[model samples]
Target: MSVFNSSRLAGKTVLITGASAGIGAATAVLFARAGSNIVLAARRVDTLKAVAEHCTAAHKQSGVQAGGKFAVVQLDVADKKQVAGLFDQIPAELKDIDILVNNAGFVLGVEKIGDIAESDVEAMFAVNVLGLISVTQLLVRHFKAKNSGHVINLGSVAGREPYANGGIYCATKHAVKSFTGSLIRELVNTKIRVSEVQPGMVETEFSIVRFRGDKSAADKVYEGLQPLVAEDVAEEIVWVASRPPHVNIAEVFVMPVNQASAGISYREPKV
Candidate 1:
């Protein structure tokens, strides 16, 4: 087996959305360690700065040279005006992004169908579907001009299998899956590549956000199972990006061993 060489990522610039924390932040650090310049975009500028610092520290630890610069941008992808002006906000040096990680997304509540809140539905779709599309549209245009780029979207198991109490979120991910498929078909003849990484049972602030800051409730989501962590998914993302240009890793469905589906996980009983 040929050993994967991460050096290929050196000097490449990557733009990541929702990069304030979780998988986005982890991906930034990993890419930085690989000597890639990173543009971290999120609404929380302070948190983005912290992530940038972590990226710098990771690059230093890796001993890589001549790369690993970072820029933090305040972005709320849900806002169309902000998404439209994103590139202008990026540093000129990092404007030519080699990779776009569409990671800015979230879930609001777990209300079942008949009782689902309209506001929650709109909020989830705004960021997860529409916001993702807006960013990708802008980036794909740039990619076409350069004739090269990679769009890596953060999808979820819910995209493949819908679970009760997560209808809207699942629908949004399904839209993402569909959008990724369409993009792959559209870019088949181009050097530009499109990929989706669907992760399952990740133990992140995701659950806390889903539970609206109810830490105790969020904790229960992973009560007795070793769920995947941000690093796990981030490693997969970096690995996907490290592949040779001729190779396209179209889609990756990653889940913890204990997770079989969106709602089906083998969590051990409390002792």
Candidate 2:
């Protein structure tokens, strides 16, 4: 149950986006335990440091000889220039990333496509779609040069099954899913691998962001259900990246037992 006794990541470097909180943070820690050097990117420098500490502590406990180092970068994936600059600063040792997790994203208030604010739509695309694509392009170039790497893109069930009030968010994730398929096709003969993880409903800051800090509203989203936690999704990501290079799990969809699809889940009455 402690961080020590975990599998050694063994000489792999992983660069994760949106790692300041939620799934990104959880995945960073998991990779750290596997002994992978962690390069965390996020907008919050303080939060990034906290995450790095968790990774470092876990590394020490694991007795894996510190297979890799931990580094943090304040990055806003939404900006093209910032994303480019972040990649350029990859530490020499960690430059050859074994894995890249594109986990930066946000959700505005739910609304019909026609009722969605243009700003919300633009922001979502900027981070979810443009940002994810930009980071992948840069990493692909790196992987192509190195002749090996794994890319794990975070998507949502909403991407696969559109929801009434989730128009814009669904649209962005749908783009990600499509891009993952196309990009993998383009790299068919290369050593680089592309994959996407589509999660149904998980308890995290997602609904908080969607409701703009409406705790009551966010709580309701996960009420009466054992929703997926951040680590649950992160575990899948780490496992996919840990697989042999010869085997690339292209797509993985995770959901809570009570949930079957996007926004379709069994809910019990509050006791």
Candidate 3:
């Protein structure tokens, strides 16, 4: 086994949403390497399959002759019916999962409140807010019955501070924070742990999606300076998960060295 994994997460089942790309995909790889069986769910079947394969490959690369199992489910967490159906189809290996990474979320257009489309606002709330809650609510019952599990919600710095033209997105993230917070209290005195990993300006498909497929605009968001990559945030997720049973890492605020907050970064001009 890789020294990184050390079988620390051996035999655990981890479920990751938004596992088709970005931090979700990266986290699946890291956790699999750590000896966790992974269940990857995303809206894109083709992309989710690739990520699931990558998870098993990571275990092989870690020198484990028998790699951990990887499962994939095409899921749209924003759709409650789909979420329920997706859970029903989980393989035995993924049942009573030890961890739930609520990473299936998105940011819609970055326009002023007035200019933002109602669809954008609704979609953001549907996925980023209610979607997270739906998944967590379902899992909460499961965890309570088992009296064990961990929940890691993917929040953002925007959740703590809103930016111009990002009000709707920020509001969605803010709701995430609130939901996770309440979860902590509800799960208090239980073996279940609740945590949030709020990232700052990670350069992922998030930017491209936010810009409506404008690659050049997405590129500019990270031009002239380093931004947190999905892998960087993935490492943090693994680290937090690997903590001792007694240690519940309630929150982790991670960012590049150049970033002090959301939309507040020190970037040098290109020559």
Each prediction's whole-model lDDT (CA): 0.93, 0.87, 0.87
Off by over 4 Å in 1: 1-4
TM-score for all predictions? Answer: 0.98, 0.95, 0.96
Looking at model 1, report the run of 10 residues with the lowest lDDT sum.
Answer: 1-10
Instruction: Give the number of the best model, judged by lDDT.
Output: 1
TM-score for predicted model 3 compared with the true structure: 0.96
lDDT of 3 by residue, 1-271 (tens): 3334446577788889999999999999999887788889889999989888888788987765433888888889999998777668788767768899999888877788789889899999999998898888888888899999899999999998888989998999999999889999988989999999999989899989988899999999898779999998998888878887778899999988998987778989778
Candidate 1, residue 96: CA error in Å?
Answer: 0.6
- Which regions of candidate 2 deviate over 4 angstroms? 1-8
What is the per-residue lDDT of model 1 for residues 138-196, given as tens digits with 9 covering 90 to 100?
99999999999999999999999999989999999999999999999999999999999
Which has the better TM-score: candidate 2, or candidate 3?
3
Inter-residue clash pairs, candidate 2? 8-34, 9-34, 9-35
